[model samples]
Target: MNRQESEAHVLREATADDVHLMLSWRNQETNRHVSKTSHEITAEEHARWWSAVRDDPSRRVLMYVREDLPCGVVTFFDLRLESPRSGAWGFYLDAEGLDGRGETLPAWLGVMREAVEYAFDGLHLDRLDGEVLGHNTVVRQMNRRFRFVEGTPRQELSDGREITVIPISLARTDRRQR
Candidate 1:
């Protein structure tokens, strides 16, 4: 594949129109399973969430655009612009794009690279934090590749199953060294 096709993901600020699409991706079986809360969300619930965050300065919900298609989403929440200059982040790809396709891994990597740059350089944040389910080894590895240092694991219940959530953090200096 050409370089552009191989690494063409872009992150755009999500708008109100993206609510349904974001919900669809979030509610996918695989996505839900790896999430802290595995239950499916209703339209009403999603609408409420969208409304709450759409105008919030402390949160940013972005969509990953690849070849003009929105293939994933990345979000930064709990932004502290004062003393800490940090935020928590999460991301998920479109389920349809990840069905044994050869593009999934590369697409994910490109999106993550862009997301981290946006977090540190574009947003000028001191640190970014992420929490992944312990069972989601792929994501855990990806975070490491991006220089996120793993922290103590926290136990959480998801769909009645007790799972471990691994916390990871990446500082601005970490990205600078990369």
Candidate 2:
């Protein structure tokens, strides 16, 4: 993608209309394989989750817009709106859709860039944090490229199996240095 094309990608607050689309993306095999909770989420369960967080002040659900089309979702939760503003974030792309158009890689990189901008600029956060499965080296490397410091990995039981989870954080000072 060219500079203009990359700049064209942005994010908007997700609305009710995008719920099912987000669920579909989250349930994709590739997404599920890497997620802490890999079970397929039922529509009812998804609805419940949406209901709980839709109007929450501490959480933000954003839709990734590429050329005016929504192709992915980014979510910020565990938000602390006080002096030291911070939050945890996660995202999933419309892999099938973007892959068909040969835009998957660009979208992946673009979304991370936009999300970081949103956290530090739009949200005026002091820090942003996230977690990655230990086995997901690509994401770990990508997070590092964004200047996120990886914390020590910890083990967790999920889906009846033990998995290593790596925590990562980026302070505003570190991001500004980038």
lDDT of 1 by residue, 107-136 (tens): 788788878988887788899998988999
Error of 1 at 49 (Å): 0.8
Report model 2's TM-score to 2 decimal places: 0.94
Cα lDDT of model 2 by residue, 1-178, tens digit: 5678766898999999999999999999888888999899899999999999999999999999999999999999999989889999999999889999999988998899899989999888999999999999988888888899999999999988789999999999888332
Return the TM-score for candidate 1, rounded to 2 decimals: 0.91
Q: Rate the local accuracy (lDDT) of all candidates.
A: 0.86, 0.91
Q: TM-scores, in order shown?
A: 0.91, 0.94
Best by lDDT: 2
